[model samples]
Target: MTRSEATPLTIAYTATSAEPGVNIAALTDALTHHANSALFPGDGEVTLVVQGRAPVTFDLTPMRGDQIEADMHKKAEQINDQLNHMLAEVAAHSEILEASTNGLDVLGVYDQAIAATPQGGEIVMVTSGLSTTDPVDLDAAGDWQLNPSGFVAQINPRDIPDAQGRSITWTGLGQTSTSHAAGTTDPTSTRARPNSQQANKKLHTQHAPGPAARQALHDLWLNLCETSGASSCTIDDSLLPATPTTATNRVPVIEFDQVTTNCLGTFTLAADIAFSPNSADLTQAADKLLAPIADALATCPDGRRINAYGHTAEVPGSGDGIGLSTARATNVLARLQQLGAPRNTIGIPTGYGDTRPTVDNTPNGAYREDLARLNRTVELTITN
Candidate 1:
């Protein structure tokens, strides 16, 4: 059968329960298994529309609370590890076909889609799902759709059990920039050294992408995916440069002692941002959590440009929480602007969502606030 005839070029994932908690890794894996078992059968164009609650949290700890920050950060690392593992697995397994992402990043989903799609196949569109659906027809002919029954949307992390399904919400889902939000306008500007440990590990990596090198890196991923057939792609977050500078070339790595990387000091979880039963709006308390971020940026040297890096918990079809990731990104950036950050200086908040996690989401029952918290941070690479 021709590629089109083998299966419905488009397949949608509807979560049985809207409030499935923040354990998106589990949900995504379950959905992938279901899709693999049901839709694709063997291998076909995999396009899933995952409609469910937003699984993520954006709570910052109080001041003078290193222990809370340290613990939360550690949890974040663990969650990231899980996400990365899942990405590698997906890259390894699914023959992606022509796929589109609602929250995954260029690096996270592009390679997988490229590997799955044959030459002359359509270019995958990685975007947001505010509600219904975003078009994903490369041929510009197929009309696709994704309808969320009663999914909750949030911008924070923490499972709140209620008459509604248990869910982790990000109080800042459509708020403002947190870390580095890069795109065409605010492309991967530079490969500068980091100002802090996290920044150092991410921004100063030798193999990090530069202007001339980024395209090649992107193309390499695309080519790898095109030929990968059914292989997963995973990259160590440590390898990524922390402070992404804006330049036409690669910048040298900045050491930890050079600048005060403690721009945001610590993230204290005041009250986990809770979403209404099933929408992506931030609660009053959740909105308060992001106000200090603007203050954090204001304390930066020039305070003009700050990186808004997006993350997620998990969602069905498109990894654990990539959809949540992008939504959080958009939310964070919006919040920052609302809190008074200049619009132009603020880069586009990009979401890698649940495609890359720092922990594993397998085995038996693994659902909790801490685990979800691991996937609910927005890194900021303060720029001069």
Candidate 2:
């Protein structure tokens, strides 16, 4: 299959002293997984925003891909190299300014990144999700109660541009760290103590938020992204595991028909192959159709739930239509779990049956096969 051109990508990253510092190595791993995930298009421009004392931007020219290759080999490598150099700069500067954090700088960076891409694009923010500076101080006492709606309301409208239907992803929230310098451990021997004790004391400290706090942060960002008119918002607080270099440039495996601003993803499967005739058993072709849906569900961040609803056409003589529909919904849920979707994130499956059809099954006393086909579907909605 011929591939279409990829949309441009913008990444905004910050590691400040107010919260735990970001692990550069882990970030590298995440970026590699992201780039290889095929979510980014080839021959697309890349914009990097590093938030330090201020927001610093780096806009790389588009890197064209080879037409003969199925994946973005040349483009991914070039983008990775360019981004790595920029991330190195962020790391070096972060070390120098470890005592202070300008968390508010991310708003300006978001504005700049969004304004730069008027047509549309994807924007990724990697930060602790805690802002210590003015405008919005998440770290301040009594601010923990701030919800997404309240947070967005307090922000200056002029500071953040409308997302214009762009995709926004916020990750690495609440991942904080600390580091201590080497110190003495011996009561005597004033010569700076033993090397072994000193070395162990200088370890890096990593801290993750409790489940409640993590959920609050996720909700705040998810709300902000949606309020900004983003087409979709994906917030995953967990640190991405290290992936092998061999997996760095693979094609994206998941695609959806549409993902609303509310993060509701709808996938209309092919009715002919969705299930066996008059039975709950899914056909082999249904596996291919549902695979991407499972992948999409897996990306949902914590504190959110996935609710799947099954709908079927109106079969006049079909006995137990509701039972069949419910059974199909249950099977779909089970298949999704088998396909790697988190069981905790999925809610109980629901069957709408023929009670709610997308189109008229028998318009003017004539059965419409096309209309009925459109009604056979499973809708997945994500909510906080």
TM-score of 1: 0.28
lDDT of model 1 at residue 364? Answer: 47
lDDT of each: 0.32, 0.54
Worst 10 residues of 1 by lDDT: 142-151
Q: Which stretches of candidate 2 lie over 4 Å from their true place?
A: 1-5, 19-44, 52-104, 116-118, 141-148, 180-208, 240-384
Model 1 CA deviation exceeding 4 Å by range = 1-279, 315-320, 364-370
**Cα lDDT for residue 48, model 1?**
31
Q: What is the lDDT of residue 29 in candidate 2?
A: 51
TM-score of each: 0.28, 0.44
lDDT of 1 by residue, 209-249 (tens): 12212212222333333333323322111111122222111
